[model samples]
Target: MKEYNTVFPNLIDDRYFFQDISIDKLPIMDKYNGMINVSAYTDAAEYINAQDVTFYGAWLLNMLEERLIALENYLVYDVEKPELVSYTNTEPTGVPVGYCWT
Candidate 1:
């Protein structure tokens, strides 16, 4: 068996930096009948508010942007790098064509 080791600076290690939030019994009325029901309810989102952060957080964001740019470049790759050749095939009788059409 073989093992690989990876190391990085002891930076931010908290994955779930934001807390989970739940909004129950949210108002969701039917547009046609104007009737409210439990089936018509919606959910509020739990998101990270990055208003306050350290320099490490900003540096992580910059690294993410660079990675996204690299991914975009890989997606829009052009396979055809050469120009097509042009040709002419005609007879001296001014018939204007030859085996090029066949």
Candidate 2:
């Protein structure tokens, strides 16, 4: 199902994905082109979607594009096999043939 006007820092299923702010959980800033309305904290629609909301907000769209690229390349861990058995426990820990726990 398609959810409308939703946003999250990371997937809810992630073990370490922490929810930042309640305001961030909703698409309140989306109406303002993803600007943080410090003045009008109640109604997001009250905030104008101007580019010059702030020096950072002014370039938010550009920043977001860059951020998405970084996120796409984010690595929780090495996808390929890692060297885990460093002489301490070289025996197989029941992992896949080429997998190791770090």
Candidate 3:
């Protein structure tokens, strides 16, 4: 019997720094007579304010930007080298491997 050890790094740990907001606490709109009232919008504003949605949203955006920058910096690939080489067909009846119709 053999045992393997594996470790995975957390990428979005900062996302969990903020407490989770409940969906039930969010505002619910009323659609009476096929129209929504201004009170629904006001309730939504209140909900947003109470949950600090804007602040967390901005934080998430910043985190995403940082992660993207890190990924771009970490990637090191040779642009001069061909990634895929086309295989020539030697058989008379079959299509060649890595052949493109266009």
Q: Local distance difference test, per candidate?
A: 0.31, 0.41, 0.41
How well does model 2 score by local distance difference test?
0.41
Question: Could you tell me how far off, in angstroms, the CA of residue 97 lies in candidate 3 after the best superposition?
Answer: 13
Model 2, span 1-102: residue lDDT tens: 111221323542222222443554345436554434454533433454332233223235555565565455554332354665445445655666655444
Score candidate 1 by TM-score against the native: 0.23
Q: How many residue pairs clash in each candidate?
A: 0, 0, 0
Q: Highest TM-score among the candidates is held by which one?
A: 3
Sorted on lDDT, highest at the top, how do the candidates line up? Answer: 3, 2, 1
Each candidate: RMSD: 17.7, 13.5, 13.7
Question: Model 2, 28: alpha-carbon shift in Å?
Answer: 24
- Residue 16 CA displacement from its true place in model 2, Å: 22
Of candidates 3 and 1, the better by TM-score: 3
* RMSD (CA, angstroms), candidate 1: 17.7
Q: Name the weakest run of 10 consecutive residues (lDDT summed) in model 1.
A: 41-50
Candidate 2 lDDT trough over 10 residues, lowest sum? 1-10
